[model samples]
Target: MGEKLIYMDHAATTYVKPQVVEAMLPFFTEKFGNASSIYTIGRESKKAIEESREKVSDAIGAQAREIFFTGSGTEADNWAIKGVAYANKSKGNHIITTNIEHHAVLHTCQYLENDGFEVTYLPVDENGLVTPQQVADAIKPNTILITIMFANNEIGTIQPIAEIGAIAKEKGIYFHTDAVQAIGNIAINVKDMNIDLMSMSAHKFYGPKGVGALYVRKGVKLVSFIHGGAQERGRRASTENIPAIVGFGKAIELATANLDEYNKKIMALRDRTIDEITKKIPFVKLNGHREKRLPGNVNLSFQFIEGESLLLMLDMKGIAASSGSACTSGSLDPSHVLLAIGLPHEIAHGSLRLTFGDENTDEDVNKLLEVLPVIVERLREMSPLYENVKRGNKNV
Candidate 1:
């Protein structure tokens, strides 16, 4: 082997587990059929879909009838926002969300704003947190929906979802959460949390891409996102993607079954890396809340260093990481999440996100530790900002 690829980008995507692949193989070849058809093969397809639905539902503590499969997490988010916006228009046009939400939620909210809805984008503190009091204060009588992410994709800040859920419930307003990043890494009980709707994706949890699910609680009115076949109970359309759905079911089943053990392993790696990186590097600051964050997330910002340049150097060494969320990585702008957490634009541009996964071992983390300080030192030497600060010419 040339070299193993040390991937620290689990928040972006994950490789399909062998078990998930095996579970999906039969659906693609032997059981190929249109789920809508009533023939023998069709019945098998329908059966698999229903089974997967139950698996996904039970994984998140939702009823089987409430889970609606979508093409991707983005689609699930879009449906949750637009469906509620249109159906509850007569009730209210105001929505509550945070500034650091994934673009899926932010962009959809923007689209709704153009259509005459009002949105309140709450700001986070230095550690990227919005208190339950802030959420309660933001609520208005005309606020129809409150969609906040269960965990942030960039800084891995775990929101007080249960607290906010209670606030929304007390106000009788609908609540939705984009739990895509939190699903496999954290345990969730939607019923206990009082969440009315939630979004999830399989690729974030060692399953195939292009498959996602949205949870809409019973008695909640949501207009159809797609009008076509009777699939997804007419809430969503398009023929079922049986193979991917099977993979999704298997992935969630395995992930949730041993979530605590998985978290222990990855959290060890994450904390060790943080300890080493911060202790060894000067002028490096940790991002997100120290104790109340995801198990496998370590975000940092090195003064005078650019994140994209560091990522390029890391890539050449057979390591994969991220500057921010994969959805907004293409943009030259600094992360909105970083800004919302009180980072200046220049400091935000220097952010580095290293997220862990099941496949990452201690050796991978060690390799990163070995190479990271050298890279940061080399980059800092070339930076005029560092030179000026070194000579006592300027203050940080």
Candidate 2:
């Protein structure tokens, strides 16, 4: 009866789940109390906060004391990088990261560089993968921290985090991963992964926005990033956001409850979408590793057409997708992740990213497969580059 709406940008963010919202609603009104207050309601607030902390910790196989809430994944990332960098500055000034990290990690590393820190941005292969050996080779005695993302936001490539973590562990360097894109999508044990510090955003996993957590391993030296109150064990300060924290805990609990099943379902839909699209469209390239990527991610680059044009046409068809990370979508430049994976500027500009979620279904994939080929064809017909190719112009 109405226009169909299909959303496939779960990598950017997910809508809050009903169960998470239900868990949070009471905290906003009747449970409203400052966690720092000394009253009974305040004590209740503190209890809820700690319970949420334990939930977050358990989700990632961490200890209750290790979880510290932050304003967002970006803040968690900033604190992890700068906090570790400053605390261990006496030891070394060099940090190692990948060239394809989210700006949250990349920008923080850049900021530290301005503060006299040296960062080694390791390059990835054409599939956007960096080897643990490369990390080992890049290490200098002054390398104090190794901050690589668990998975890429744009390309959906899951790095060998455990191997890198092991390398960092052997080298006695603090390892941090911006797991904003990997959390809740894949099974993660911070301990098994040998991660010293990790970052997460609740909104990426069907929890509310404005709440995230950083997992700091015991004995990790991290200088206080926020200096004010005594909150977050004197590390991060500010009044605790109880509602959002509750939601985060509940969201992760639900997400991890049946991780394998969720991945199986989403991966099926993702594969179908990829297969159908590639079969129908010519001159299309898959952006990430075919088997080693996130289950729900499908990134493709279509030749001879601009990503913006394709997105506009998909929007008209009631299909919501993305050209790159939503945080960097406003930029006209091609995605750095695409370029790092060896896509030429033209193909990189034409890249599309579709990330599925629990709510996505076969119908959604069907709609996408039905409409995307037609859209690509329509846009390419309007492209002068495509016309030149048709005319046998070899330069393009």
Clashes of each: 0, 0
Q: List runs of model 1 lying over 4 Å from the truth.
A: 393-395
Q: Measured by C-alpha RMSD in angstroms, how accurate is candidate 2? A: 1.3
Per-residue CA lDDT of candidate 2, range 1-396, in tens? Answer: 256778999998999999999999999999999999999999999999999999999999999999999999999999999999999999999999999999999999999999999999999999899999999999999999999999999889999999999999999999999999999999999999999999999999999999999999999999998899999999999999999999999999999999999999999998998898888888899999998899999999999989998998898889889999999899999999999989989889999999999889998888888889889988889988898887895546
Q: Residue 59 in candidate 1 has what lDDT?
A: 93
Worst 10 residues of 1 by lDDT: 1-10
Error of 2 at 225 (Å): 1.0
Q: After superposition, how far is residue 381 of candidate 1 from its true place, in Å?
A: 0.9
Provide the overall lDDT of each model, using Cα atoms, as 2-decimal numbers. Answer: 0.94, 0.94
